[model samples]
Target: METQALDFPKIHAVLRTNGTGEVTINGTSHPIQADDEAAVLREALRLITDTAAHLGRPVKVTTTDPDGQGLIVVSPEGHVSEAAPAKTAPRRQKAPAAAPLITSVPEAVPAPAEQPAATVAAPVQTTPTPAHEPDEAKQPVTFASSVDQSQSPPTAAPEQSTRRSLKETSFLVSAPVLEPAAHGWRGILTKLGFRMEPSAEELTEREDIRTVSQHWPGPRTVAVVNRKGGANKTPTVVMLSAILARYSGAATVAWDNNESQGTLGWRTEQGGHNNSVLDLIDSSQTLLSPSTNAAEIARFVHHQTSDKFDVLRSDENEEGDHEVTAEEVDIAHQVLTRYYRLIVMDSGNTARSANWRQMIHHTNQLVVPVTAIEDRAEAARLTLQTLESRGGHDAELARNAVVIVSESTDSKRSMSGDALKRAKAEAQRIADGFAPHVRAVVRIPYDPALVNGPIRYEALQPATQRAWLAAAAAVAKGF
Candidate 1:
């Protein structure tokens, strides 16, 4: 077994952005920089500590040596360690970029809105091998991503690559030594160096980074459904669209499939053109014409300028009394499907609507989103029940669905641990039933920024971005 441990050196961990790309901490702004993962990791821990304090929670982020090289840990009941920096700093040299790396994550379960908001998934288990352990047991497992060359980063391996090639062949080989940075925020008073055992928060952050970096081939449809929709569906569409577009950089679209007035356009950025799905339906003949192209079709859909997905909004005018028909939806869907790799539909409240049912029927993967509220959760349950009872393909769609339980956008303001845990349990109970019938279950914690109007992935806190990234990764598996 080759060693999986590589000296990370002084790395800078940036708070991942959704729409915008900056991470700020302790009222001081930090731009995403080109430093190693360690510095960024230290900063990330600082961000977590800051967020917990802002939420008026007792969670604390502590390091063994406040001024020495040590490890950082966060705990609600004060079970964290603190350390000081090394008195005589060890001289280190920069090593060459390590070999291409890939990670596999267990499906993550996000804590409910009220659980001190610790992390994404469990931390990458880095418990050191005991001195007496056999060497062969140390070899790690590897897997490849399925995205094409264009979508793959420079470091990503080809799809046909195997774990054997990914394994480290030289356990004792020498590499250039990299000196840890001695200045800047990485040299903060509370600097905690690296440790063999990582905190759970650190593990979740590492997993989120790997998840967001992956890419996959796709031309898939994701429906965010909740029959009792008042405001949830549009955000789900926007968030999923943003995260997917952010990570994959693939062409993605979000269509507001509301029968009547829908708020998707209002919540997202609107284009200069007042064109809606109606315009697309009227122009489908030309758009779908054999000679037509992707750029040409962009004229009808609303493009979310910041996040890279298009929006086919429903008619939002109060005076407009038009209800979309099933045939029109098929026309619009076909047109979008031709040009975009992913389409996320924000549906109306009617489960019986022709377009709504059609969405479920044609959906590649269904995403049933519910808030902690009872009525909202019930609506999600009923929608799944309706599909299960309907049989045939609908049952299959229900079976392969991804259930998402989210905190209300404004949930943080009134959150209490006991109340939050109860809400999470309820949401999990709903998710538990579908566990047998679904592909994945994702939970999203509350983010105040997403509650208002437009969502800027950049403006969200680190924790918010982590949650979204984790949820999006689960959905991307279906792709």
Candidate 2:
């Protein structure tokens, strides 16, 4: 038997934005740089293959990137394949049958020349081999043409009964069934008894759904930020919250973290009462009390019936002179976090405000939304730069931010032919500019539903909904 002890050291690689990352093997770290994440993975695989060649064994590698985690095995001969998870349960081997002991032996007798005496042969006795025995003894034995058909075969010994120990049997058993396809031609065929697999597009959609429908260890906060008005921050927050809540079935809230008079309430469905974040603060003492029921806190936040998410709007009283202070932000956040598992915040156009900075400190994921207009894009860039300059948790959030570039809504109505083509090109160009700086960049097409009126998940165009789902999945990956 070939030796199973020839194992190579495992490699761990992390791919960051702009194709720069680090790979660790056998406790030693190596720098890896390339043009993008795909290129970085290729470079890391090459390094792993080289290590395998040097050690004359196949190397296993684990990777973490924007695409998520993966495990692969790389061989010196340039062969690569996904590595299956290692088993943890102890293995059971079938015990060999014990040989019968002989009591007495008879002397051999010569056969007569006239007629061959019917030869009586005793059963062949076998000895058990020790662990230290040669490898040849361990080789499996085969009997075929050597056996005489006329002679009766020896009675085989019964296999020693082997039963799994109670501990070896797992009480936690998972379903061993496959999910049938439910979309495209595969669905039709499956219903007709063909059992066809899902198409690539259906598979991709399922993956995106699975990605968004995940819950992390604790409550996660995503900040949709841009320090410039009309950058589509509110729309981004609404769509992210809607997608997350609809798919994950978790308590999600879109909080207007603006300082004053935010438009989130105007663009979303309202509850029975005209309550806002300020109202929530006024009732925080009761909401945070041990006797407070989960549903009791819903009085201050409006619920979007179709989107399956709640909205915590900013104070919209034009006659009142008030701003959300940093301390007020903390109080509101504490109350909301107690009731919601996910918080998608819409920011005001002031990055330097105490409330805005306080929101940043609690953010788990940063999303920058910008229209195709040059000023909006510039403002988004400046916001990320400001965070990066802070040099701590803020900088880390900036480096791992997700930038979403949305096409200008007015362009679709006013532009056409060459003008419309140029508009789309501009949006793509803006999205590309942020690809190197942030963890991911997603481009959203202009949709009429997002231009004005109350925003609802069902009101958006199908393409617009898909784009938002992809964006939400990308944000979920950060958690």
Candidate 3:
């Protein structure tokens, strides 16, 4: 395996003593649980063969267990075998020197009279010139000619001659780099003093983390828009803000930008004060004051302890008739921008509202969230169409929007066999519909954690978390 490079997609597995392990095929990870190491490997092998069957070929896997790490090749037919040992290449033997041709020797010339050795001053030591610098005074020396005692030796070339180009010269070159592995069996081997590189999955995960953790020059806003109820806009806002804050360590807040009663407050934890967007609007003047500190803004926004983000609710009073106007939206936005580096806004169902247009005006990135249901998908399409028809920054946002297609909440519980398959196919169909019209479209599997209550990142399944991370990375690229 060391002597040859395999072009097949690789699998990485690590089994722990607590009957828990992870198996990553290609770049997607799947969790495995069993009673012992044998069961773990059995499950891992099943996963490997399933992936191989899907790809219609074989795959190479590197596994780590309590004993140690090993490599194997598994085929779609369920055959598993140890990888071949490394073989050293054969050394080449040197050919014998050919005998010199027998020919008459030329007559030697008579030597000239040797003159007294001239007193040559010690060579002057000069500082070494850098590679980028042209050494004009230095000339090439030849032993064939006698020393010049009367004048300086000739220079290598005339001043008008072209100097060596920096592009052609190599300077301060380092040895080849070895990317250290920090995941799975390869990482274990590295910890044991062997050098290895990370797998493709680990590299991709690192890149996604890096993308979400980036800091732009100014405060940026993302508006999750879909002018339909139960479109998953609030969950999208919460998850995106959570991922951004958790990875970037930045001040991120998810604001409910609804004109009327919004469910964001119901879905998120409440802070000490039940201050809403209406309260913030009233205090915008004070919050915008230069003398106000950041801690004061915390009173209006609810803090999520585990998710590491803040949630700014809309007017949660059911009896309240006051709706946020465009002016109030600007007021709240200005104050929030002063305190938060990233703001993710959750919008209401009415796209024609003044507050909705105001939120769109402040958005730097647009995300459209939709469930797999037909009505939700149609609503998302109509929402984008409305924005594109405006023909300005709104159109630009619509063109660059990231669409998230989520599986229906009831599909997991009510569907099975062909019904579940049809549900997934429908989700994919919806995702495909948006793929051509938007910058990116991500399909999220149904996760019960996001169905009800405050959505926590730790409660999501591994696949759901990976999907959201990818979605967040896609949104970050817009910034």
Greater TM-score among 2 and 3 belongs to 2
lDDT tens digits by residue: candidate 1, 80-179 = 2222232123422322244232232122122221112222222221223245745344322100100122322223234573456535454331322222
Return the clash pairs for model 2, or none.
none
**Ranked by TM-score, top first:** 2, 3, 1
| Per-model TM-score versus the true fold | 0.58, 0.65, 0.64
Report lDDT per candidate. Answer: 0.60, 0.74, 0.75
Model 2: per-residue lDDT, tens digit, 340-380? 99999999999999999999999999999999999999999
- Candidate 2 lDDT at 118 equals 18
After superposition on all C-alphas, the RMSD of every candidate to the true structure, in Å, is 18.3, 19.9, 21.7
> In terms of TM-score, which candidate is stronger, 1 or 3?
3
